[model samples]
Target: MPSPFRLRATALTTTALLLSALATGCGDDGGTDEDLTAQKLSWKDCPAPSQAEGGGSAPSPLPDGQRWQCATMKAPLDWNHPKGDTIGIALIRAEASGDPSRRIGSLVFNFGGPGGSGVSTLPAFGTDYDTLRTRYDLVSFDPRGVGRSAGVKCENDQQLDAYFQQDSTPDDAAERTGLLDNTKEFNAACDKNSEKVLPHVRTTDAARDMDLMRQVLGDTKLHYFGISYGTELGGVYAHLFPKNVGRAVFDAVVDPTQTSEQGALGQARGFQLALDNYAEDCTSKIEDCPVGDTPQDVKDRIAKLLKDLDAKPLPGILPRQLTQSAAITGIAQALYSKDFWEFLTEGLEQAYDGDGRILLLLSDSMNGRSENGEYSNIAAAGVAINCSDDKPRYSPGYVEGRLPEFRAASPLFGDFLAWSMVGCTDWAVPGAADHPDVSAPGAPPILVVGNTGDPATPYEGARKMVDALGDGVGVELTYKGQGHGAYGSKDKCVQTAVDGYLLDGKVPASGTICA
Candidate 1:
């Protein structure tokens, strides 16, 4: 069976709301943009320890869904004080049925989000990921500060509603300043409100929580596949608990080593490349894809359209207009699935004319918001997880300085997208994780999968992490595919490679390219 691709049933989104809850510690650049430089920080740099979330001993498993049960686990709101009070962590389990005698211990999975929720996945992914379910009793969880488990909400729904509506791509100095100020305010609010939870949102805490789950589950070893940001979680696990590793597969991996600027730039370039792919495929499908005959032409033309939107958002069905931020929401959604490419074209066409329905739908999907005014717990957990994982440079002037370059590279949606992280600047109760180098020391070989044109987690990141892991154990398998997570999209070649690795522990031979 192929290793499962995480969450095709759900669309990608951002969890900016959590940042506002974390406002206590965000920073501003008093100096010029050039003054913003990567600071070398260490474990000592983490935020001060705080009070844990409900420290009543982590609760036991609860009846939840078909093939899965919920288990309440807990870790310190601060890992530094492991013996201190603990917070409840939501966990889910789906045990193998076919032959329990052949069980391969528990496999824990984390679908990445700075705010991604693992608990919600059981209902969405269910047995569709049977390969993983059939061997180990697959476990998923909502790390602290996520849905149905616990969260440190600072802003009310109305404030969050207001925040998402803010244009991501700032047009003039005023718009830019407004966005900056709003972000600072949001970040500051989080710092003050979520004092306890914010201090423990780091990946290290989540990883440690996972370790506690592993022990609680009675699994002697940890077998898992972590996609997108989940890759960082696995890397940290490997770095901290190498002895516990087992049959680990990191697909569409993240390069945890890069600085925030490098990371953002890498994403910008990846989106540019993915957009090139979209243009080619889009033009092949539609005779008039806006730009000239060439793909670059389409890219350039689309770039111009975004800039136009930024300057004067065109009116649409809803109160909001078509802005560069909205365009990006559409573009990123399309990059997630080849099937959604038309959404981008339709959105562009609507913008060319005057419609915002399709664009709003894309934004809705990107925001992971439901029609009922509520949002994804996955997104909520994602921000909690991301803000605490590794520090991103959030100086006030940072976005202003890099705005031009990001916009130039991602003309359709770059500048405001770059500014999307303003809330992190004032993140409170830091408690960040250590930069774990995950080489799977002395452990069995780890399979690293990459899709050629994965926009969110680029293929190059897979290569970079693989090379950095140094141990002779790293294996890279390139799927000549598109989109974000690629392990389970079902191109026979890709499926076969992953199946071979997961079942037989066979790493795809180096230089192996599977389409």
Candidate 2:
């Protein structure tokens, strides 16, 4: 829950289980000068989540006997300037429940968001940590410009409140101008407040910090679990430090090979498929469904609601009305997990009754906007990372021309998702090269997991990631499931395969498909 367009688990850090079927053994560390001198982490007793103080998602209570220790690592704000200004990298280590002498080195976890707070998620590892803590220490960190780290602050709670309610889909010239004006204001505020860190929060920068983290933890190589956007970060790390690659898994893959426009268009198609799946399920199961019996009916009803909101916003229980942006955000969030589909049904019911409270709350929850209007910097940092990583694939005129294609991709969500990229046209900084070849040569077998019906990151993206990694470098594990991520779902096959990999460095056979 960060950007309106992206969906991720609220608590689980990028959950990856990899059984490395054919990975080459790890090699010597890429011991550059900086790697040799990386500061050792000084661990201290962990503090309770600061959500009570008005930031971060409130994680579930820690499980019995699970102990958490906190630490800070100092990394160069700019990797290019090794002696330049430093920033604190917040880390949390979940001590292995098994014997210390038998413990493997730390396994670093990243729940994508580019803005997702690893510190916030560390406590909420829930059931998976129970098994993970028996083998290796579970370590997660806030990448620079993320929670606990020096986050990218742009707007206050009030400003973000107004921003989220602004029309996301710009139909005409006036609406487009309003949307662009708000985006410019948002970017300018971020530039003003976070000038020192904004230019350096690229995924590559975080990947560099990961090397330092690996060195500090005294591991010869990095064992990584990265999800969604975290996969992008992990891919960068693998590219930069192939020699240091250990057991790594990238789940719910974001294809590093695709341009930003392709990502958006691809997502539009994925979401439309998910919507169809949801519609089929709802009609068969839920009584009095708001969208009627067929997928076409569902698409029509939702599209009408979005267009109607564009013309006339609906008053919600909160002071802010439910605008098209908020409604779309709410809908996208529910698409992440089937468990939340009932919430979607309830929300649609409320929307039909002219009460926007449920839908508005869903949007806020997805954005990490607190009940009191406080906001996490997830959206701010997410944009920074996204803009810095790659150039936008479409210009304003190009996007306008491609509208028909996007609409074809997703009858309900395509236009809005496609237009979402327009903000990149006025980004504060230039992006890195788009869709560069990323093959971590000399790395162990990297397991890439994909959900067949993933909405945010389509299944094709996962296939693309494997293709980018080349034959034998990356192994593909397919889950015939529905959701943004596959590992945490009820499929015991994935969980068992992951366990096998982490426990014994086993990798599943290539092209292994599990349900």
Candidate 3:
């Protein structure tokens, strides 16, 4: 299963196909000191996305006819030894469209995933931020060890197919052994294929790269729009260079205070809450609920279906079966946004009839698998970055011991998430810290937006992030909405507050609510 923390803004569109395309080759390492900061990027017309970046055609011109430009920024391969070796950080941007007098440098974006390709993602959602583009160059990038920027590689497409299909929620010691063996094999593949880049892909490293990017972009301070794991990255940047932070926003915020195990437990509960909300919304509709008569009935039926799938898998996409793990993943994917609930309803309806294509497609989206059976490096990078940043290496025994607590939090999602805690087993690199440090006493106020119905990062994490970001640093904004993020939900109040802060430097009052 993919990490619960992975958030792709465009994964819900199944019709979108990614063709096989050439991967972006890494640039040569640069020499020391002043030369690096003074490096000028050679921006050009953006090309079709590479296979590792989740292949797709080049971004279309903006509504106003401005073409998206792509470039590579050089940063030290290892921050500890800045003069030693360098790696390229892929970037995409649309220059500010408004008056020259109003231009406010760049507004960098990181759309979570810790593994997502922002070069590809920013184009898909470019229009959503056109208002902000009036005053800032809308920019986003694929962080180190992600897409085109020294992307991490592990397992072939075929290997990944079997890997994701294996029963993640093990039933016995034999099944447990198989799961561990598979995880070890995947980790070994990453070590073999991307050994040079693994140790340098931590969030702190990415934060440092952003500062370098700020210098290269000729900006006095870093202006950012971060979501999900990006929030953690932004917080780290603030901690490292609080005075360098310009106007920024953290949506779908991750809790910086929780350890890996605690984070997983929170996700189990968060996903369960989203599921409950989804079920309630379905049943409350005037139209007769197709899945069940009541919310409990809906959940009970889903539990039964999962139990049945554990024994006899349903036929899904060609040559693949919808295993219990895939179904759970598909369900989790749908729960990310309320807009996908109808698909979840349809997927469940199809599964009940012994057809599993829809649900499997959802699973594929969650895993970053393209229609052509090619997968981006999202899973590989997700595991690598997660393993490198998280200090704990959970044993199967440790996971087994915590099953009941996880299950108590979410009966449907507990086992899957609990088992995922062992993802870093036998990792090539040791982790950096117990949890990320986001404390920034001197940073500017960052508008922190939290969706009450977020399935990946729980609602409570918003407050935790605010508290962890230190006094007067994090400005909390609540959106009583559903989805992985509040801004993308198109709530007028939320967008207005964010636009006001980013475009006009008018921060909304702390603890402001948007319903």
Candidate 4:
């Protein structure tokens, strides 16, 4: 799904990366050396989520059960000076179900987003991993700039509400000026409210925190399952401590090889391809589909709707109107999973009938705007982490110059996605990061999963990631399906490959395809 805060990947087939894992060296200290010691975690029961007051949706509630233990860990704000200004890393651990004597070690899970809340994400899946849960404690943490941890806060609800309602697909100089103005406004809000934590929340810092968590959890090596953007985190961890890398799975892999602009174009094409796939499915499955029989027709219809919305906003569910931005977001949200296609169809059908409540609602859902008018910090954190992680340089003229290239990439969704990068131009901190060179020479075998029809992270990017990690060390598992992620799906082949790797150190043969 194209959240205003997520990253993108593209198609560029290359040779698989392979290099046998052999004993090698430790990572060069990026800067300072302070003692890296584990901190004690005082586990306590988690409080029940605040109930949604009246109508609309709240984010999915924490799953019931007392199996969850909440704790906070102290980590340096500056990894170079570990003893200096510390920040809290919030963690949630679910104990294993099998015999205590048979227990393996802690299994760390990250659900991408650079901003995704592992504390919220873990509980929904800890039980579903069935066998793996019994053998190891499933633990997840809110990385420094996310969830209960020291988070990045930007514009408040009122400001963001108005921001989301702005027309993203600007048609003229005036609209373009407004778009850039809003970008600067949001950027300024983040710098004003989160200056202390913004520069410190880089991927390297989070990877360093993971190592400390492993030490605290008493694991000799790290066993991790990271999806989407999480794959980048896993890659960084493996590169930093190759010897400490145990069983690791990087699913829906992001190519650590691409620059930010390349990644954007890649995602533009990927989302376009996914929309085509959705169009094909709709023509065959749904009766009287509004998108039509061919992909081109679908693109044309969507383009027309966006143009119309740009010219005149539609009446929506509440005070806000359905602007081009929300319409694009709603469409992109459904493209993430095939299961959400029906909702997309309903939303489009309603829009066709001159009522935009469904599409507007879906957009709000994707953006994490709560029913009671409060907004989640996800959008803020997402922008903060991404901009800090990779400093994007694009003026309005520069981005405008790339418009034709973007539209050529994806006729319906390209321009909006490409222009979304403008906010990073004025990012407060000059990014001191890049995609980490992830060929960890002596790491244990790492499995990378790719979905053939994934929209957010393209299949080709997965292949490229494997190539970057090296062919000998990285194994590719393919799911011939549609979705942004492969694991936790009903695909038995994927489940078996992932489970076997995490539980029994079983590696799927090279070129393993899971349909």
Candidate 5:
């Protein structure tokens, strides 16, 4: 909930199972230096994910019995001085299953938390890309300041629980002051706890690290798959090293044209659209929707629930009540995927009955909390990177002034998101630009896939990314679907288009539509 603008598509399968138990459940950067790129990685069997990566078991082997391998690649801590101190970039891979002669080099992927741990995420969805692995080593890594890569650390788990529980949408001056104080305290903790890494975790720094990664991996060009925030990193890489890009694909594309404020506003509209779609889908079903009698009814009930919760909180996972902010966060989490819409309906139904378990569980997932109550570094690193990359810092007055416009965009989510713009307030380091520079004139044709109903990075971003990447550089493919990303949605048309391009170098015609 730190930077609501941050996009992530974490697996919710385990989360769904938890909900059935009691109707409630538990749950970077850097650069260069020739010697760094030439360093060898000692691949080993992956250990259980560290607490910072969101604790879980070691990744299981692929369906074909090929084991997943792990390694650490050293990269400069600061891109400005590549030969200075270095940090390890943790990596994971499943080698190609096909003939060595048919191998098309490593296909690197960034699953996009700007903080999501590729070291842990890739295996969770490994089988989804087995087709591509037939001819390429499927690879991913924990970007600097994430997971095992000297991950940025802020408040201790206890501090974070209190931080997140505080009122996020203030109704008066006292509440507003509390919100700003909390934001400042959180930022100060990040600076206090992660001063060494905070200033160096911008997207531009991560892009340079990818170039070094390509060299270390023995690939001539970086064949990449970027989703959500990953798309922004890819675009920056293309702009910085256009000629070195090869067979890249960006799904859930971020708009390179907007400032941090504009991006947040766009998310307001995008999420409202997704919520509308969710309401319509639920009510239009042959079976009666348990949450409401009609589409507007569904939304109306949800709005009233939020209003009621604001005034009087409900019991959530024991010892933690579901506050209004948590409910909104949970709702936003459920809207990320249509697959989770069932869970959303159930969560709403349960919340209405005074059982806040399901909704709070969803909120935990969004905040990177595990069933055992530990949190991943996703929140810390997301705030660090966003604050470092985004130049503008908004005052409480500015947010107050924009409330009307944000509310106009989304009555349910507007206040929550508008207040999130202050996540960077009183930060430790200066930001890099008004927005990322992604104009890559000479980059290869990068396939850009957009989902019509993506809540995080709205569909319009795909076309903007295509145009910004320069004509002929970004090939646009539209998936008339509902999810944060298309390829992962398992739409056959999307899979085929992406596989053809990444596997056989077959770029779909620009503006290709997949319904």
Candidate 6:
């Protein structure tokens, strides 16, 4: 089913990004009745969604759970020409639970993949909306080029599989060279295969789509909740339609202006910092962390493990390579969900035992390879979205040159993670113009959340985004949690403060720290 917040990517496409004349956006208090009337005749014919086989339409499927209705909202394929070539976004609307006497309107959610499908997030975030949903329709959708949307797929599935065969973690120069060559070939394939939608995957496109969704749902305003890349998406929408924002919450915000190279460099430091904290926690449960005693010791052992796999590929838990690429992917994925922290040791053990099973599973999940050896529809979109959203500059020497900074900042993940963005170096076009619209943001004082030790988005990033968004007049909410998105984790102290802002429209006083 097409989902919301989460999305997929596309191949390099043609851009006839002719700015279309769209109706004026809804005002800050959503819009006046006149605003609604003004927009009534503007919506185009949207493609109707196909019914999910054998499902009823309630909130979600809950014969024992709930049911869901497939909803579609029409948006311009390119917003600059709003009334032009139209594309329809699919949505799953989970209505409020309580008395209809007090409905809130709508709460659109974004789950972070830039490729993650958003359909399944309702049950996940529904609890928080309990009070709010009583009044609002919870709308979520997979952005264009993503699932359920007329998706963007590249290369026949088989050729795509061939690209995954390289040694993820290269031991010798030969494998590393081959990997780089493959990345270029892969990028070329994307350009040739899915060139139609690639140029249109910018965050601004998604933001405009959300506004269309709001009008279709008949909501006067947008009560948006964004996390991770989702936060970036929301920021773009707010910037584009500042007055349309009504009690929006941007958790784990992203500074879209930040380059992937800069982000990777910063993340190198953040991951190691988080790992250091994990190490402390690791020792409390397992003697020597079951990985290694000292931080450097653990790094050495993992490095040795990487080299071992480089020489001989193991029959990992999955059919992928047991290369350092596999291990690093596993580590990066684990870095986000502390609940999965225990898996690190297990992944380490399997790799250490020369099994390479657990690490493979983690790697596959990350790169979107399936167990039966099928690639996921999500990966195509993931790469497309990221490459298009922010065309990173990773030359042959980019990784090596930045190694020292990465190492100093993130002794554990510096080199490997920095190289991860290297794939983008070979991307055909540099990402779309960095949403020039984002340059000016007079959007309300949005709150920016940063964990003291978030691996994916550094604390510094949170600070940077908050400052950038409000011209250095935003509030920073720090929850001493360890995960990619912490707001929904039910950390009472954090929730109360965030809820007050959303429900009461009260900004946390300046310098609010929620730990």
Per-candidate Cα RMSD to the true structure, in Å, reads 10.8, 6.1, 4.3, 8.1, 3.9, 8.8
Residue 478 of model 3, lDDT score: 99
Number of the top candidate by TM-score? 5
lDDT for each candidate structure = 0.61, 0.77, 0.89, 0.75, 0.88, 0.62
Model 5 clashing residue pairs (backbone): 27-371, 113-116
Q: Compare the candidates by lDDT and give the number of the best one.
A: 3
Please write out the lDDT profile of model 4 over residues 1-515, one tens digit for every residue: 12363521110000000001100114632333334463568988754422111122222323444367878888889887777888888888877777899888988988877677777656655656667877888888888888667888888889989888886777888888888888889889989998999998888789888888888788888899898889988988888888888899988888788777777788888888888898888877647666565667766777888889888888886788888889988788777777667667777877877878777766765565654566666677777777777755677788788989999998877888878868688888886545456778777789999999988888987888788777577888899999788885668899898888888888999789987
Backbone clashes, each candidate: 27, 7, 0, 7, 2, 32
* Candidate number that wins on TM-score, 4 or 6: 4
lDDT over C-alpha atoms for residue 491 of model 6: 83
lDDT for model 5 = 0.88
Local distance difference test, candidate 6: 0.62
- Local accuracy of candidate 5 as per-residue lDDT tens digits, 1-515: 33564554553654776677756300022235768878998999999989898888999888789999999999889878888899999999999999999999999999887799998888888999999999999999999899899899999998888887789999999999999898888888888888898888988878888889899999988999999999999999998888888899999999998988888889999999999999999999999999999999999999999999989999998899999999998899889889899989988998999989999998888888888889999998888888898999999999999999999999999999999998887998998899888888867899999999999999999999998889789899999999799999999999999999999889899989999
- The digit string of per-residue lDDT tens for model 1 on 373-413 reads 55554444455555665465466577678887877776554
lDDT, candidate 1, equals: 0.61
Tell me the tens digit of each residue's lDDT in model 3 across 1-515. Answer: 22554787757554223211110001112223677899999999999999898887889999999999999998899888988899999999999999999899999999988799999999999999989999999999999999999999999999999999999999999999999999989999999999999999999889888888988999988999999999999988898888889999999999999889999999999999999999999999999999999999999999999999999999998799999999999999889888888788988998999988888888888888988899999999999889899998888898999999999999999999999998887999999888998998878899999989898989899999999989999999999999899999999999999999998889899989999
Off by over 4 Å in 2: 1-4, 11-38, 50-61, 286-291
Worst 10 contiguous positions by lDDT, candidate 1: 25-34
Task: Report the alpha-carbon TM-score of model 2 versus the true structure.
Answer: 0.92
**1-515: candidate 6 lDDT, tens digit per residue:** 00111211110000001001100022232331333224432322223322211011223343224344456555667656555566656677666665677666778887666765555444435555565555566667777777666566765556655565465434468867987887777777777876767777777678877776777677767788887778878777877787666667767666566776776666677677767776668766655578888766677787677666556667764434566555666666666667667767777876677676666666555555543455545666767777777744567565676677867886556656666666666666567653323432545667677777777766776777666666733678888888666676678877878777776677887667767
Candidate 5: residue 336 lDDT (0-100): 88
Q: Model 1: residues >4 Å from true position, as ranges?
A: 1-9, 12-66, 286-297, 314-321, 377-380, 430-436
lDDT of 2 by residue, 286-315 (tens): 565665667677667788888888888888
Order of candidates by TM-score, top first?
A: 5, 3, 2, 4, 6, 1
